[model samples]
Target: MQEPQSGPDRRMFLRATAATGAALTLGGLSTQSASAVAPGGFPDYTYVRTLLTPSQLKYNPTGEIIFPTVRGVYDKLASPLGRYYLYYAPHDAPGGICLAYGNSLEGPFTEYPANPIVSNKWDSHYSVSHVSSPHVLWKEDVKEFWLYFHGENTTTRLARSKDGIHFTYDKVVLNTSMMPAGTTETSYARVFRHDLPERGASYVMLFMTNNTTDHRDIGWGWSADARTWTFAQTPLVRHSDVGAINVGGPHLLTRNGSAYVVYNKDKTSGGDIMITEVGKDFSLRKHLGVFYDSRSSAPENGRAAAPSFGTDGGVPYMIYEAGERLKGAIAVARG
Candidate 1:
């Protein structure tokens, strides 16, 4: 991957051609007419403060090798049972998905004794060299948990777990062949379940795809059963539109009858989290501006990426990867 340019062009771009025609101008910089704040009184990106540090989760007692050394925790999910499930890739090469559990967002998490819950060995459709970036969702309709992840940054696979811990390989949900022509890889998938008045109730997915030039962009997909997906050929959130070399790690949060697409911008070494409202049709609306800038102060610290949203007692919060990839840690920010 090439280094991201550090110019004014590196900022999030707001296109005047959106459906709502709502413009967002931050301090007279952007040309949009709307404010950068999200609906339902969601705080601006500058207000995000870290609640947990990587060191707090580094110690694992289960004797299962966790994300050893500098490898950081990648993504996290807050279960309805009041327990937090963290997903990470071991620091070593060919790293697979590992799990840790804890009672509090800030806590001494316990690595699962049976670590690497989903590994490359579990799927044969893709290379068994690496499998990481796991995004797990609970399906209330089926009463089962679904795990969507990628391997070698090439393909995405899905698995199902009755108890959210033990998982069984279901199928390959996304592959290069499923993408547009000349697409080389697909990864970093985030799934959202919503009942839009226009589209009805369905499972929506936002995934990253890298073209032949290695530029990654976000794309949209939909599924009726969460097993089979129909992906769009055109990019939903492209790098050209975002003004970043790469745009990925998509996570969604719905508020006040509107859906928001939160994703990472630029390379992992110097990226920031950005948000944009999504219309009923899953189209990008107003660009909400930076959610977490890596250069910001403590709690809002580091190169934040792979952001996952949750709520604690009705208060919104975010869990993301902070600092450099291998040397980074998982950090939380409360809204």
Candidate 2:
């Protein structure tokens, strides 16, 4: 792990741009005007419907467990064919990468008949142990989908898929050995492929890692080809500043030229979805504040975390895990 660099030059550039009220651009995507902040202070997200629950999933009845206990749903990615792909892990069973599908973003998703698309046996390192927090990326240049996930919450791994359903294991991308000594583990990675000439790299990853104190924070890495990575030793988003003990499960969204990282900040009751602006170089910029909270009054819906963003018919949507870990349901929200 490399120590976080104090980016004075980059900060100066961003401050200058904001002072002049100039739109930022990256990879042809224009930034929003200074006046166009998130509507209603934060995104007015309304609950749509529940997408998945442990009882609702289609799993092998004769398998080790009758109904697999879900730890949490990781993320969702959309296909050009109008299907939404969701990744999750079963707590009791093999706990590998499982796949589910639905036609609508706010859907009654069906678990793939051939689920656990990528199992623990696929990787020789952490075979049959645990693999979770899968974030998939669609590489337009190669017309293939790449999956980034963690095994045993200690190593970040990669795999590739041709049709976004079946996947082939690639290699371990990040682990404790790659970080500074005393780094306990690394996991929950969110990757983005941007076209920012100033950054000198195209691929950026925001992930979570624990230090000797077992404190989790968001770290980052950059890659030119989306394969090999160079990780930052220090955290990109710290828990102290975010007002959360554990900050993980990062998701990236880019609009106009501005980029945002939507992640969960653990709270005593549950968790809240928070958003923060990210620099073109994938550095943490400004914290935009909480976007959603699942702890309701009437029909309480425990913790809500692990957010994944998508769109249907040009309408923005979000899918997240609601309830306690290992006993949660995947829910959807629309703007």
Candidate 3:
């Protein structure tokens, strides 16, 4: 069955118009676009420093990590969890959900004592070869933290926590079963809160799905609550759309009233971030081209993937994996 599609909303366009109000000045250069997009339209970010490498972590059992999901601890009661929590894991066998903490966005973070808070083996609940690509969302209405991760590269699972450290495993939220026929893998998901009231979904998720042909594309779903989800019959963005061998690491960037999907594409030259503007209906509307290129950066070593955006002291920053796949460092960049 097909999902209902939303018509062009005048308010959405109006909001989009408002989003183009001002361009941001990045690195002594004006990189803003006239189009309605996030201010500065994905900044001309300057590489800052390597925030964390597997070797830096005191308790990196896997000796590798990727997909950094950083969130601020707002509630005063969560003082023990530090001001900020950075969640990441290895996309290898026995993958886990691990965390680090710090007071500042540009972190000198310390790994949690009880690292790998959630492991591949959960006994009666579920067990898989590896669990990686962690995306955590703080549910304000419920006053709880919800973590979404994938294991076996086929199933995306959910686990909730009151403390953001100790988690209670929830059921698998998405897998190949919910996708179109001939689909092989469904993983690398990121969720966001959007203003699409017409869709009847307060939250939306963007994920990477691989087909029988091994082509990777972006898949999407919607939910009123953060738990249950209903995905589109097809991908939201395709490798062919961007002329890439594969595309993953989906991130939702909403500014003013406009929404954009920023993801990494595997190009012959190297991996780089790309952006596409999506309508309020959650449909891919336009390809905005390369958001961040990594070929010139020596630290990135011709590759950058899985970007997580944040702002520190009003300056926009990105936390992403820099270097080759499975052999990279968690890097921080500011603009």
Candidate 4:
């Protein structure tokens, strides 16, 4: 995601890709045909309903929310937050890390009374202009939720919590200084626990990194404990590889020992989600075309970005940022 400016200019955020010489298109998996599965085993989802909009947030500081991701607690008895914790935040100024909770994946998620668990202003520790694009991972070994988000556009910070609500500020896991020379911004990160051969790392992170040329691509890193990370010399996926002007909001999808980066692109037709199979080694493989067709759905408004996937009661589901850039709502789909 591009850095949102203050006020009306915030819409300018992300003036915003695939492998294979030829992009592969999966046919018959229309959003309307929610029951069918795509050729490559992609879920053909039917848009259920708007899970959340900025307007629904009782204490929306910026009047907008972009990232919608959830993590299910194994032992609700031990977890104080709830059965499911939804994390989202505004991509605008004074952006904050907010929360909501529900008993089910298909939710009546109630916002936390004192929201912005991690506000932009933290005296003595640190303070920034804004912070948004939250991605949370529940580490089973440590029994803690690792929250990754960005502030000041160039830095991605980390925080940890046992209960999923109260967070202890960790350290900066990613920054532009760690990126390639031409890189300008790095944020909107999604981290996954995947083992890579020869790297001896237990986790991998994929994120949006912009260049001086204003091109956004998916950059990556490998981490041994989800705290410290080592960045790659190059990006995982480039805009040109997928015929997109820009791409961001990366989520990792693993199935049958294969890894795919699910991200959104900026195109003439409007932004839609696309997938690229980056195998276990994180090697750029094939472009699996339109993971979710935004053009066909009314909720999408010809745009869909930042997708997060999960399962509830043995059913697969996707929740994503839908509608225009910055001015969008969170929509849910199930197959």
Candidate 5:
């Protein structure tokens, strides 16, 4: 059977456009192009991050190998320790326990301290939900680092850090879900982080959200100031054709001059990657195609956090989620 495709239907797009006119005008995201795509915005898979097939790493009962489904990663300063911090619902000796890593994108990755970094004690946000989807970025201009994560129940949490690994714990930024009242309980969430590039005149916060229904879609809330965020009130991508079942990890990527969002879609547990691009102002976007699909091993399922991208020598790579039997192991794929 063919996998279900996801996108915004014409009627839904028309309705969303009419409802958020004022917000778009005020936020400056109204530069919608009816016919022009930003100079280079197309979502296509460059390459997938793969595992080294190290002897130290072995497969579990499912007989499928494991890897790091690095939901989020960022190089804060230059390189080395500050080079990359991979976060997920981490998988290791225990699995779905905490954040872990690989020194680089390809690994032989291990857990951090062999335990959960932040746990249920973080229950302040949502008593039942756990922390997932971490987006980390450093801002040299303000001399501060920011960690953006979402709890299972709450929309998202924003924290600042003087150093990359540790945070101030000062206060939760954007302490509320952007979901509409009637849809709050049935929704997935809104995950956002401002990926500020020092040279770029504008900043982009790649995010995912669901206004109503089961995982309606994922998108970003764009902002120039980084203080006031304008929810695309519309998702950057939609799974309208994906049968209202599953879609996750809509991490943003840019190539040349365009923007692309990557995600996984599975009616089952172990899922695969999906890519799509946005129009100049997100007024128009298209599902380029599926990069990877299907279960490699067994007991296949949907996916986990996001994937991290980097280059080895000169080849591009990615780290994502893979599951077999009882393990939702982080796995990699390459061109």
Candidate 6:
């Protein structure tokens, strides 16, 4: 990933992409499919649904177990595994993304061993692998795997995995903080791809960014190869909504022409999960409020860490983490 830059610079990339006619488009939000989840629509899947929570993971079994600083498993890419594949920062090192496997929809999962496919700064001084949550990318043309995630030194890195178990290559794609020393929100990035599947060859690099200076708002990046990122010229979303502050965790999910962003809002004042419809090009649509909050008072089980678009019980669902200790488990929301 490229080094992080100013918010204006980032947003410019997005605007330029739109001008270049290389942006995304969406139809709109739909309850038509998510509604069929339950019998009478009694909130069949409001929040408590999960494919694989942390309680099921053993160790970093496969892929990248990358996560954000939000608490539990963070952003995950589209992987169609029966269970949810969470990415997290383990052992208090910088961060890392890993994958776990489950047998059932709601797991008691068993993760791939050898935790930490990528380690914090690779056990070095500057720290190159202090990796964060990763969203996977599957490129049919290259027949290779792309793992996009955040880094502590204030940058997002990318890695290539051939078998999904062992990685082959890696690099940073976001901005490097030019601040005095530290005092930056750190570099964060996520991954998302459109389903249109143009015959040509292309990829989308979704990012997790912050203005850091005046705390402008969460920013983004646009990349075609996942290595050289052009900070989005315009923000895909804002830092707050309806007079609130804080916005992040850009989980872009597309289904049947509509793209949904499962992100966090008001995190400072008791965070809650919210969903919004966005055009393929990142235009805001229906603001679906509160995708899922704490299921119960139970010690605050966890919070919305990362989110990914998925299918639970044949219904489209967005899976996220709920526990801070990974024991609470990951949560899912349909419709």
Give the range where candidate 2 is weakest over 10 consecutive residues by summed lDDT: 64-73
Show model 1 residue runs off by greater than 4 Å.
1-40, 44-82, 123-127, 196-201, 267-269, 296-302
Question: Candidate 4 — worst ten consecutive residues by lDDT sum?
Answer: 11-20
lDDT (C-alpha) at residue 68 in model 1 = 17
For candidate 3, lDDT tens digit of each residue in 144-196? 78999998888999999888988998899999999888888989998888656
Regions of candidate 3 where Cα sits further than 4 Å from its true position: 1-40
Whole-model lDDT values for every prediction: 0.64, 0.67, 0.80, 0.80, 0.47, 0.50
Worst 10 residues of 6 by lDDT: 34-43
Ranking by lDDT: 3, 4, 2, 1, 6, 5
Residue 123 local lDDT, model 2: 32
Among residues 3 or more apart in sequence or in different chains, the pairs in candidate 2 whose N, CA or C atoms overlap within 3 Å are 2-233, 30-256, 30-257, 31-257
Tens digits of per-residue lDDT for model 6 on 66-142?
A: 23322112223244342344444442344556666454334444555776676655533236535566666665556
- Between prediction 1 and prediction 3, the one with superior lDDT is 3
Please provide, for model 5 over 1-335, each residue's C-alpha lDDT reduced to its tens digit, 9 standing for 90 to 100: 22123322322343355455422222345553232111134322222333422223332212222323342234444443423455554222222223455565555566455444444344354342345555555555686756565554345556666645555543344433554443342112223333434323245565545445656466566555454555545555666744435565666666655666667665544456667766444555777655444333432244433455556455456665555322454555442
Q: What is the lDDT of candidate 5?
A: 0.47
lDDT of 4 at 73: 74
For each candidate, give its TM-score against the true structure.
Answer: 0.75, 0.78, 0.86, 0.87, 0.64, 0.66
Report the candidate with higher TM-score, 1 versus 2: 2
- Which stretches in model 5 have alpha-carbon errors above 4 Å? 1-83, 90-97, 122-129, 170-177, 185-201, 225-227, 241-244, 268-270, 298-305, 324-326
Candidate 1 residue lDDT tens string, 238-264: 777767889878877777777778788
lDDT score of model 4?
0.80
lDDT of 4 by residue, 1-335 (tens): 23332211221221110121222223433122222343256766657788888877787776678988888875733745667788988989899998888877777778898888888877666788999999999888987889999997999999988888889998888999998787889999989999985898989999999989998999999988888899997888889998999999999888787888889987865687888998878866688777776744566888888988878898888888888877888888775
For each of the candidates, the C-alpha root-mean-square deviation to the true structure, in angstroms, is 8.7, 10.6, 9.0, 9.1, 12.0, 12.8
**Least lDDT summed over 10 consecutive residues: which range in candidate 5?**
35-44
Q: Which TM-score value belongs to model 1?
A: 0.75
lDDT of 5 at 212: 52
